[model samples]
Target: MDTVTHTFFGLTLYAAVKKEGWSRKEKTAFFVTAVGGSQIPDIDVISSWWDTAGRYQMWHRGLTHSVFLVPIWAALFSAISWLFWKVKGWKLYGLGVLAVLIHDTSDLFNAWGTGYLEPFSTQRITFGTIPIVDLTLWAIMLGGLLYAKLRKISRPHRVYKLVWLLMACHFIAQSAQGYALYEQHAGRYEQFALSAGFVPGQFQMIGKKNGVVEISNATAFTEPKLQVELKSQESADLDKLFAANPKAKTLYEWSPFVVLVDNEKQIGLYDPRFYRNGQSFLFEAIEKDLKQGK
Candidate 1:
């Protein structure tokens, strides 16, 4: 999920709490715990300032987002809240843990993935069942807020909880549909990657077989539509290119799947899942002529 969505998650969870009998100090403490925990995992981005090996790709969503770090983050946030507000309670710890857990779990659904296991496993786990910026979630949260205000609901907290439930259902449904589509084409392709479209229930599926890549879109209720196709030439040598661009080597190792581009003049690799109309942001290339001199 994106930063805005994560912030909204924190705010929504905090607001969902019943305000009855809660003092201002208690509310402020919980607020910090919620928002801080939600944003804490992304702190790894700061590592870029000190990174010299081009490992920031592997370091951004690295150990900080690990499941093993959840409790540590929660405890750290709780201690900070206690020190700042002098409001000490178990609820603060619990809310902190919940917010951190939500942040890690939600990241797993997007295409960029997360290092949830980190030190234990170097694998980048990703379901790709949800887009980074999901309009569906925004609509659900916004709708809940509007209903709560217009209906004058005495228990708005309950409405927020209901919205969470709806969000879960939405995720499950999207995953199932993507799974089905992947299965339908699995045997025919040697490798495949799935990316959720901006629209709910829509997906972009990329499958590669024998150097040919197929990019298409599908939905649970609609027929799969072919978007574009590209044939990869594997004859181009990549040793020189990889030697020149260490980041390209790292990218090749980090990605679960990739599309190799070798047209003799240049050698490059890109994540096929991110292949847009003509190029991908995740691509790294080096000129073949330059490779010879290095």
Candidate 2:
């Protein structure tokens, strides 16, 4: 899913855990430590994708996104929490571990599919669960969290635990939709490597229409997965891309500027680093080859 969704999920879970009796100062420290751990996996993408090579070899949620790293990563976060917050012993460590778990859980449902076992393999997994951005989910979650911060339970304790219940319900609803979509397309999906959105788990059908596609999660918040129009009905552009590239076999012949999808889902895409590997990707050289690969 999108980073915003992950941030909100982390916020909700981290807030919920503070009910375990930590001081406001300690809670803030815990939050900082936890969010850092949560955001760590995505850090690799900056260098990998934007480097001179433009190599997506370690882009975004790569090996750092592995579940196996949870233990070591949690320990690192815990040590940071202990030092910065002056927290003692196991309390800080426990919180850090929980925070990492929450981060992984958040990714389980969102789009972009996570590489939970990344170190072992680079496979990306998604339940085809939720849209990357869902305004309804955000409104309910962020709004209620803000409301809780504004209202007081009884004066001495300002924390409101009710928000947790709402979060739980929202997660449940999202999972239910995934199951429903699975049930609806079981045969067709299994017949091919297919992916479909599952959040709010509604039974609405989705497919291409005219020059575009539409998606309905039975919720106003969910937007279409991708909207595309064929520049040529015959896919002449694709044919030319394949014909032009010397390393055509290496790059699956996909236009990265187009919609994102795994290599397995589609065939022929260029490795991002192909153009960036050397200085040849420069404007003059690129324009020289635009006729075939653009």
Candidate 3:
């Protein structure tokens, strides 16, 4: 999920809490715990400034987003709350855990996956069942806010709780449809990935077989329409490319599969999952002459 979605998750979590008769200081402490924990995992973005080896691709959502770091982050947030607000309790720690957990888990459902297991495993766990920016979720949250305001309810936390429930249902529905589409096309390819489209109930199916990659638009209620076919140069030697452009090596490791491009002019590879507009945004290339020091 994107930054906006994560922030909203924090806000919704805060709103869902029952704060009846709570002091303003206690409320502020909880708010900080919720929102800060939600946004802290993305601190890995700073690695880019020191990324001389072009390994930012692997480091951005890497160890910081790991499940192992959740408790550490929660403890830090809890301690910070105690220091600033003088509010000390397990409730703050628990809310921090929930906020961080939501951040890490929500990322798994998108195309840009996270290193959930981290040191235990380096796999990018992605379900791709939800878009990075889910408008439906935003709508649900917005609607909840409107309903609470218009109804002038004495207890507004109930409204936010309902919002969370609706959001969960949306997630389950999207994942179910994505799974069905995956099963529907599983036999056609040796390897596959699903990228949920902007609109709900739609997906981009990327499947690779032998050295050929097929990208298609698919939905549960409709036949998958062929989008494009990409051929990977499986036999190409990437030693020079990796040596010349280290980012290419990281990209190669980060992606589940790559479409290799080796020709007279240059050698490179790109993730087919992000293919669009006649090119892939994740592509990394190096000129043959540059590699040869010409």
lDDT of each: 0.87, 0.50, 0.93
lDDT of 1 at 80: 88
Instruction: List, residue by residue over 1-294, the lDDT tens digit for candidate 3.
Output: 999999999999999999999999899999999999999999999999999999999998899999999999999998998899999798889999999999999999998889999989999999989999999999999999999999998999999999999999999999999999988897899889999998999999999999999999999889999999999998877888899999999999998889999888878999998999999999999877866654
**Model 3 residue 96 distance off true place after TM-score fit, in angstroms:** 0.5
* Steric clash pairs (candidate 2): 1-111, 177-201, 251-269, 252-268, 252-269, 253-268, 253-269, 254-268, 254-269
Compute each candidate's TM-score over C-alphas. Answer: 0.94, 0.63, 0.97
lDDT of 1 by residue, 2-80 (tens): 8999998898888787878888888898899888899899999899999877788898888999999999999998888
| Model 3 CA lDDT for position 84 | 91
Best by TM-score: 3
Specify the poorest-scoring 10-residue window by lDDT in model 1.
Answer: 285-294
- Runs in model 2 deviating more than 4 A are 18-25, 49-54, 154-161, 189-294
lDDT-superior candidate, 1 or 2: 1
**Sorted by TM-score, highest first, which candidate order results?**
3, 1, 2
Error in Å for residue 64 of model 2: 1.4
Alpha-carbon error at 269 in model 3, in Å?
Answer: 0.7
Listing every candidate in turn, what is its Cα RMSD in Å to the true structure after a full C-alpha superposition? 1.8, 8.4, 1.6
| Residue 123, model 3: Cα distance from true site in angstroms | 0.6
Highest lDDT, which number? 3
